[model samples]
Target: MKTLRAFITMVALVVVGYLAWNGYIEPEPDGDSTAKPTATAAPPVKPAKGVTVTSFRQASRLLKVIPEDRQAYLRSYFGKGWIDADKDCRDTRQEVLARDSLVPVSKGCRIYLGKWLSYYDNKTWTKSFQVQIDHLVPLAEAWDSGAYQWTKATRIRFANDLKEKRGLVPTTTSLNYDKLADDPQWYIPKVNKCKYIASWIAVKARWSMTVDQREKDAIDRVMKGCPDRKLTITRAKIGLLPFAAGTGTSNRNVTIDSIVYSGRSEKIILRNTGSSPAKLIGWVVRDEIGYGQYRMPKTVIPAGGTLTILSSEGRKRLDAAGNPVQHANWGDVWNNSGDTATLIDGKRKVADICRYTGDNSGKARC
Candidate 1:
């Protein structure tokens, strides 16, 4: 009896223990149930440097095209060995794609270059379906700058040279066509100018290109602002000409109305003070700080007028005609290439000549 009673108690305890374990213990989570995930921190963005790059634009005047007489020769020469003429872009686009792109592909006859990134405007696109093929030196500019005299073969080579075409930086098609051939003076991007100038110069130098006076002046102006040596060509869009009024004649009476200094050049406010309206030829004199003194071309200031001057720091380093802008510390007389000016007889004149002895300070009181 005692043994049976003890066994029964043991069994009861065992059953209670088993019930507690089964009822209280939690089961493992099913495969479908999941724990919440922790959130991650994002990376910080950095600020842009000093200046931002912008789109490229055409200069003021319309760029001219090569003369018709040379077209046939160029076509025949460029067209030669073009066995796949029906579908391919001859050699110009093909070579350009090969040179400018990272991965260039050939589709039987037509060549296709991969996508490109435009540093100027920060746009990206592939060179597929007639995209990305552009002119390095614009076609119109070539015509005006002596391409008119080139033989058809020469023009054709110029038009389709892989080397030249390689410079056809991928930019907005509209902006490229807008430049049409005008000098940088009339056309240029407001930002990213240094790159634009350098690139334009590289193209001009490569082709041994000649420019008109305006074009030459444009090149000079652009080069003065370039900071980098390699970032030559960039995208561009034209800006309004703030100081193109007195471009033909020099030595015109100029007023120093406004003064602006960009990292690259100086912008001054001027007016036409000549008796008859004059064309601004070019710059002649500079101030101590290297700004242009704005003069008449023939060293003649008009009878009753004023002209403003624009200058670069480079100009102040040299004389009006490419000599040193030396100070007149040698003798009793002030002898700097650029002396300050005052209005005299309705004309703004520099103090360098014999008539204006004490007028170098640029004070109206004198």
Candidate 2:
């Protein structure tokens, strides 16, 4: 009986110690659910870091002025698909449409039939189909400029960025096609040219994508008329995990528990080993070879709960709150033979990672 009681006491002491340790390190939760384990919520994303150029000339100088390799471009490398960030059936195209629409857009899971004015040509449309979401920096151009060396996660982050409308905009289909993959030297918008050039420079400088001498020279020539035009680009804001924006410690207990890849597909399990719920908004799970990449939605992982991400749609999955979130379909991301799974936090910090190679059973514990 003494031995039994001693063992029970030891177990209780260990559990208490763990909770105390986590309570000290992790953000303390306050009365509010969103509060950090300590009552402060993590701050929502802000342009706290990166270069802030007040004028167009300064913004232009921020870019790595160099010649692009201009390699044979493959559109698929950058993965030009939109994401349903709000769980609305509509992808990024519809989101942009809704944002740009002057009229009330339909609010349905699979919808967004609305009106949009394409500033590229100063034309307006009543139907969403008439407008195209134009990347201020064309994907092909971005790839050549420097994106070719980026990982799939980086590519997806660039393509599906809904944080700011500066990078992507709604435009008429004809004009979008006309400007396809052409740099400023070859093509500059006829209307709203200053705004277009400013946005273009903003995108290039924000992504830290290089500019060839010709591209830089062209921008210099175009901006001569508007030399002091103001432009602001927010870089490193892509990984914004929504928070209350006050005093609180960042939760560092969330980590990858394991990576399971079958012969055909892949899934990663993220576990939060903290005392409080871990808000994983803006976090990213990606494989090294650009096959599977998932930027987490505005979701929370209960202290002890686990969330699984499949490369493609598998079964109906539920988050910690029992809410169903539509994870993006990354077609065949893992190498199956060998790959590395990395969990990157909103601050662009690698919280945890797991590597697996030649695992016939296809499960790697981190």
Candidate 3:
């Protein structure tokens, strides 16, 4: 009887050990397991640090230089209010709070307590209400630029755009109120001026919005101060709908327009042939050799617009030649002998490819 009992106990121990090894039961805090853990919600993506000079120059060139046309302000035109566009049961405001909060969210869409860093004033807040969601490009400003002509649906998307980080920012309430439809000339806390201007221009370019002469001049003046920074605006996939009639397709046709493989100024040029503006925010340019890829900065290519990307060394050389170099810098991009330059969009789709053979020759057949 003792032997049988001992044998049964041993079998039970083996079974338990197998189960534990296979993760049939939850392991203790320190135990290891082979089973994959269930996935949880991903953290919110942080906003881009600052845009490059190349991207800002491109966006500036595309901006319409006109006088501001004041229009009547109507909050109702944009939509009811903070919407749960993502179907996450949380409104846009709550989403922003949850994203910017230092502490984890407690209960159902409520961020009762958390820490927030305000970019506008470079202040930190412990209370939720102290921080307000700021529309980087105000609705009235959009209207003056051309959104007044947009459909009600489009206007709502622009107003409540949670897709692009630049579209909305969490700032101190006082600063939000103080910035009332003003251009970049308004105070943006000296430290954050570059990022602030980049976000402003990016939001405008992404939405195909225009800028008046004063707005353009202000942006240009600020950009002159940040010669090395570039602005690359990637298009937000969420909250955007199909273009209205005669607005053309949402697809942006970007191609590897040209490549300068040889000489002192080696660079790749891209062009948007589509009727709608193309956001090159997440696009990648690459070469076959070394498989080196250069991710584009957040920028927009207006219809029929062209963007030039130069290597870091090339940009420095060009800047020395008295020409204001507006080119995205990819370090040592091309092979002198021969290489292939390919353009890939945000969706991982191949947009265009250019190839060249380097016989120590001047310029590839791109």
Candidate 4:
């Protein structure tokens, strides 16, 4: 009987120890023991960089099909003349002069003495009048391509686009007149041929403008000689033009109006709902992963104006009335899903915030 009691005690102790080990040391099951395993979320994908011409052959292949529309070209269709689109009290021509002059501007919106390098003919000038603001792509060429079908507002915007660096250039007046309404078939100095062609391609592509057969052939021929040439085109959209009146503190209110996080063609729209113009010199747009900082040269937002920051790769979508939407280039800004965009002003104040999940279908939700 003693041996049987001892053996039973030993067995009980072993059973108790085993139970304690499982109860205290081992991991406990979830509330529902039969619950399925949770899935891990996949990593986000990065957007592709903007379209770049790797080679002349590639550029030739990518050229748009020649549009057969022989639209009537008229200067008035674009705009009455150079207007003060930026509302800086200086007209577009004066603004270009002020920006391109090597010397400091002397008078109000006038550059009496300055050095300007005209790339078209390898000439440099000191007199401001000697240099004419030449549109990289002429207005008539734009009409022949696709501008004829555009709304009046869109044409006006294209005609007086001071936002884009390549849109208008400071070249010798003689060169500007000689190359009037001519395509790439015209002569460009040997040194500037490559860049000239590239700029031409960039402007056409940015405006969604087409090329004629002759124009395409000319580009192809020029590019064939330049095998290693590469060109990247970036464009800025024009914001709303503020009215002359109400130049007060109330007009200085600027906000992050909208954001489009769709794939490569991401865009952020900023609006100045105030009565006075708001300067966005050191403004920043940040998403979860990356951010695009604005370094606008003349960073003034007119009252009731909207400034759109767009990605380089997005398709140029138009409004219902067929007016070309203006946008600035902000490459690969937002993620595909679960992203937050914050707009910070020069003073480091949060101007606006937009948060969304999943795809936005290229529309701004915030």
Candidate 5:
């Protein structure tokens, strides 16, 4: 019994010693416990307001043209005095660099891209080869703007004359290529149309050009985000569209999502994909069966929206007056002669329905 008691006492002493050492002699937390760390997130990517070709307008304030003969005479007499070859007035390249660049460069009258940034692809390149000098008013386009009526001398003067300082702009080579020969009313950079319209206006004004109502309507769609019809194209005035809560945005608050297309055959449908309510504006349709591809507007859809598959065509569609027709939905087979409808958002297309097919026969798809 005495030995057992001694053993218990020794054990108790050991336990007490161990507890004391653990409680008082511990290592520090390396300050990690005391400090709170912050989260590092990527900066927001704000939707480029007027980031499109429209920004070019702010710098373009001149209009009217000097007669080509007078300009040539000035060039001949001055001999690089009044008119400098490729150095006279602002060429499209210099003007664009001055307008589009974040950091612009110039050597006397010539302007070069200090850094090549492609707005269409959201890409940044180091060399000028990646970029191109785009003509806001293409040569063919210049013809439409009244250049075709002019003499060759006048055309040449207009083509390269810096005095009018109307055409030529440096942009991403790809973008320029894609936009070549297309009208401003038809093709505009999806990212910043307001900018495109303004730049378009600037070129038109400089070259004494005019726009029809249809073209004006397209421009209005983009300008809707601006404070008014008369919007100033600048970096600061671009505002944000209200998206759904928790949709998540970058530092610039541009939606991380995009609206896409889906369907097969000429009789097709469109759908809204983003979390927000997209405005269904227009569409593009092509049918090999005599119905060549066409661009037209859906009467009821809004800009920047989507179109649901409310109905179809190939399957014996209906008319506007709720009537039935023998050959309603198969529009491509009967009219256009194709079997595909590729609906492009923000584009226009034509839809056909017999007056007696669906609810309303002889009624076209609005």
Candidate 6:
């Protein structure tokens, strides 16, 4: 009887224990749950550093093929006339005149009397007044190509570009008017037809400008018949005209890239999207409200590089080279809700402006 009782008690105990274990069950404690898993963030993709083309054929191919972005391109959209980047009295016209003239500037940055050979008509010119400074890629054509999307400051630069030798030419007023905004296909120069086409392709490539099917076909047909030579082209968006105006040798385009409105790490970043260094000295950056003006120092932003302007402490800070970082105490100036940053040249002319509508992203690429 005692043995039977012990066996029965042990069985009862085992059943109770099993039931209790199942009733008060806990998870494996491996940190797994029914919640959805968080996603891993992706790394940022960098922009193209730039491009180097070996020939006119290659350069021509480099142009992005797109239809004309025809907005009623106003002449004023590109800003008034020329820029005196060097702060010299000579604006872009006189600068180009002084440059293209076979003789030195007749007087004080003026090209009153000089010798010039017009590549368009293949005629030599004597008086400066006889010839006008012509944009190889006319502004109208540029707007039709891709510049309609550019900023006012950029348009001003393009209109007054004296940086690249191929961009601006001294030509007779008659031919200048004749060419107007026509591409090589429509308006062919009596002399240097191939040369004109090459330059057109080059300018288009340099500025990252696009060509319509017709424009592309015209250049392609021209290239096939000519002896091909290597042509180095850059993709800076028609490389906005010149560094500090004409002194810039390479096609230089600068843009107001991003802005961080507040905090100790607040900053406004400007990037030289061009392949050449851009002179930023004497340039002014200001918020929409008048007092937030910060003048750029004597500095040049190298191609593909950046100029970061800090807030507050940046004013007294020195770079690694012992130069001032060129900054503004913009925390109080830049409104987090919405704001605008305008870049003006030494002449107090607007160069570029970046405007942002507030967002959670914490930075504005206006």
Candidate number with greatest lDDT = 2
Provide the TM-score for each candidate, comma-separated: 0.37, 0.51, 0.49, 0.49, 0.34, 0.51
Compute the lDDT for candidate 6: 0.72
Per candidate, the number of residue pairs that clash is 40, 11, 15, 8, 53, 4
Judged by lDDT relative to the true structure, which candidate is superior, 1 or 3?
A: 3
Q: What is the C-alpha lDDT profile of model 4 across 1-366, one tens digit per residue?
A: 999999999999888789878885444367777766677988855434553434545555555877534532458768899898767678888888888877777667655678888888879899888989999899988877867546568789898887666789999998888888887866555567877887788777767677888788788777767756555554424232121112212223777677766755677777778776666554556666543543222255666776766756333454454322444455666665667877765544576778887764766567
**Residue 292 deviation, candidate 6, in Å?**
37
* Residue 284 displacement in candidate 5 (angstroms): 34
**Residue 217 CA error for candidate 4 (Å)?**
1.0
Off by over 4 Å in 3: 1-54, 236-366
Better of 1 and 6 by lDDT: 6
Clashing pairs in 4: 237-326, 237-327, 237-328, 240-306, 250-275, 251-274, 251-275, 251-276
Cα lDDT for residue 8, candidate 1: 100
Superposition error at 273 for model 6 (Å) = 40
| Model 5 lDDT, residue 165, Cα | 28
The residue ranges of model 4 lying beyond 4 angstroms of the native Cα positions read 1-60, 187-190, 227-229, 235-366
lDDT of 5 by residue, 235-336 (tens): 211111122111212211111121112223323333333344443222333333323333222222223332323122432333454222121122233122
C-alpha lDDT of all candidate models, in order: 0.44, 0.73, 0.69, 0.68, 0.43, 0.72
TM-score of 5: 0.34
TM-score of 2: 0.51
